[model samples]
Structure formats: structure tokens, C-alpha cells
Target: MLLVLVFSLLATCSTAEEKAPADSTPLRLTDVSTAEAFINSAEVVVVGFFKADEGNGFKEFLAAIEEVKTLPAALCSVKEVWTNYSINSDTITIFRKADLHQENLQLSKIKKLDSDGLVRFLTINDIRYITEYNQASAVGLFQSKVKVHLLLFANRGSTDYKPLKERLGALAPRYSGKMLFVLINGKEKANERALGYFNLKSSDLPRVGIYDGESDKTWLMAPGEISIERVQNFCDSFVTGELQKEKQAGESEAKNEL
Candidate 1:
């Protein structure tokens, strides 16, 4: 099946005061221009599409969105169709801007009715735009049912990690709720344990690793050019169970030379 890629332009600038914590009330919009601006400025914008005379469920859902501190939150009515990629009653769409490439990972649901339902949707979906892990979040990542596709790096100071990060962002939505793409900074003293456990070194610079949380197994990619295709191949092969068989047969991860 051909994948449909939805791209959205994000606002590059906004007033400082506009950066306040998510409001108790959503940024109500009656048109597309303002809705685009609102979604582009936030990390993850949850748009609640409902008629003005509709039930109170959507209103409650928007209220729950206001309290979700993990991601930037917003909402709009169905009348505003700028973000209506798949519009329907009580349609809640999450527009996530992964990078400067403007490639968005849109996850939408059609039937959620209230604040509790919205919270359940977010929890069940485990939709995170940037899944960065440190010593603090490492255990949780390991315990998750989803596979963790992690990038081990020394620091973000010298190297241009933005491009690689953008690539990961693009791939993340493809896996959506199934995979956890994370970045672990090796320079941090607290993260040394995680680095050592994975047999990684700070001198390795940038490398990719995959952890199977269920089986508690890990596979490392032999250091090479960090490109979107390379990482995508790694993830694709890993998901298909091909990489593990190759690893057991004593083959290199440089590329499946067979």
C-alpha cells in the first residue's frame, strides 16, 4: 500500500507571551489560516472537530487537552477544515511536526467523546513526537512493549544532530504507537550506566541501537554513515526480524551484504 504523507507548514515565529503554558481553554478558531498558525507553533496539536451546537463531550476533551503538559495542545471546530485531512464527527487529529522537512505524522481517531476518552486515546496510543531518553527514562523505555530505536550520541554541541534527528522524526510516525525512537546523550554522567550496559563508548560519536523490550535483547548497528535511508533500513529490517537472524549468523550490520 502507498503511504499517504501529510505535510503542514509550521509558524517560524511567535510572541514570547504566546508561549505560555497550554491554556485551560483551547485556542478557538473559526478559519483555516489561524488554525494552521496555531498547530504549527505547537509540538503536538490535538484538534477537536465538533459543531458549535454539538454535545459537551468535545468541550470536555479540549479541557483535558489543556492539562496535557507532555505536549503542546490546541483544538478547533470541524468548520475549520485546514486540518481536516479525515474529518468526521468528534474527530480528534494529532498533527505532529517532526522537523524542518515539514513532514507531519498525523494520528487521528473518529469516536472519542469526552475528556476521559481523550486521555485514554493519548495513553493507549502512546503518541510522543520526540522520544528522548536519559538515565531517568531509560528503564521505562526498556519496559515498554514497543521496540526502542535509540540513537546513542556524545553530545549535540559539535555534530549536526538536527538532520539525523529530523530523519528519526520522519520515521517515527510510520511506526507511531509501535516503536520508541529515542536519543541518549552519552556525555551525561548519569547516562554512563546505560551506555556501558549497551557496550557503547562516547568516542563512537553517533551510533544506532535497537532494544527489544519484551525479550530484553539488543542489537547494535556497526558505525557508518548516519543517513535517513540507513536508519530506515535498520528499523525496517529489525521490525521484520531479519536483522536478528543476520546477527546470530555472525554477519556485520554494515549492510546486508548477502
Candidate 2:
């Protein structure tokens, strides 16, 4: 069987993706303009392009979509739209507006197609509002159109972990389109480098930080209680320009020290 390769565009843009209905049937795409509309209409979408009769893997794709109602899905039988996406043959493509990512799974290359495999593929790449940071998901995070990230750092098994994650996750959507929320598990050995980037250790958690991707700047929220109100205020401060003002003040102080 062939593996999955997700390709990022030169830049990222967004419309927004709404959760599909419980029925989970893919929207029928008929033309180039409509295809363009569907792709741009969401943060992520999966569209299977086939010649007719919803060719190979369509049944499996259907099963996968039912399990992943969070991602919008569609079917394109029209060959004309395929060329626009550089799709020459039967393919299942996952489109993401966050990073302008286009991932293609060629049916011709896959020796076997199973609903379970398709489900894994879709769920693994299904970057949500508050996503856990990992090697696999880092691909989606870096591709986000939203340059600023509000990150939650916590240990996996700690008493405060689950509630903190859920708290921030609930508060996350409030900053949607403005910022991306990321969870960094301090317990993961693989994430040590990420911890080091923030000059943090597992002992120093659970902390909150803001990373501005555009300028490659990072700021740690003051060490104290990690309350939802505090997190909300921290996010609002960045949005209200207080954070940038503070950065400028710190720069001025450094100059004065000089």
C-alpha cells in the first residue's frame, strides 16, 4: 500500500470548515467553480475525485467520513475539476485552508483500501481547534494561516491535566481565526526540544505561553494559577496590543540599561 504525503502551499489562507451532519454523505461536486468553493469553504475537507459510479475506495471513504463528522467531505465525479488540483487520476484529496495544504491519496497506487485505514488517515490529519503537539501534528500547526499560537504546556498524567486541557479547549474557539491553540505534553520525551525552546522543563509546568510565528517571538505567561479567566485575559491582551506594547517597553528598558 502507498503512504500518505501532505504537501503545503507557498502560503496559508482560510475560509472555515463546519461540522457535517450525522448522515455524513459527501457533497456532490459538479464543476470547477463549485469545487473551488468547497475547498475554500472550510479549514479542512476530504474530497474523492473519480470518473463515475463513485469509483474505488468511495465506499471506504464514506465509512471514514461517518466517523469523522468534524471534517467536511465531498465527491467530485467531474474530471474537469481534477486538473485544477493537478489530479490526473482517481484520487482522494484532503484540503486544508490553514496552510493551503493539499494531500492526495491515489487509488491506483493503493493495493488495498479499508475503512479502518482510511479512518486512521483522516483522524490523524484532522487538526482540530485545540490540537496536541506531536511530530505528526506539527505538520498542520506550521501550515496554519493563523500565525500566532496560544500554547498550553502540561504533563499528561498530572491531576490538573485533563481539566486544564478541556478548559482551554472550550476557551479556544473564542480566539478562532485570530489564534491557534496548541497543547504541549511535558511528559513526552520527544517534546524535550520544544520545552527547551521555551526554556521550560517538565518541572516548570503547567504553564501557558504565546508564540508569534510571524516574528518568531515567544512569551511565557506569568507563572501562577492557570485559570480560564487568566488564559482568556492573556489571549485578549495579545489581541488588544498590550502584549506588543510590553515587548516594546522591554526593548526600551534594555536600551536604557545600555
Top model by TM-score, which number? 2
For candidate 2, what is the TM-score?
Answer: 0.63
Superposed model 2: Cα runs more than 4 Å off: 1-51, 56-124, 251-258
Per-residue alpha-carbon lDDT of model 2 for 1-258, expressed as tens digits? 001111211111221224435447789998999999988786678998877765788788888888878778998888778888999888888886433468788988988788888876775566656777754466656665677889898988899988898899788868767888878888777666666656788999999998887777766787899998999999999999898789666955533432
Residue 24 lDDT (model 1)? 59
**lDDT of candidate 1 at residue 191, scale 0 to 100:** 53
Off by over 4 Å in 1: 1-25, 28-70, 74-127, 134-144, 152-154, 251-258
Error (Å) of candidate 2 at residue 64 is: 6.0
Candidate 1 has what TM-score? Answer: 0.53
Q: Against the unseen true structure, what C-alpha lDDT does each candidate score?
A: 0.54, 0.75
Model 1 Cα lDDT, one tens digit per residue, 104-167: 2222333435666666554333334444553223433443445454553535554655566667
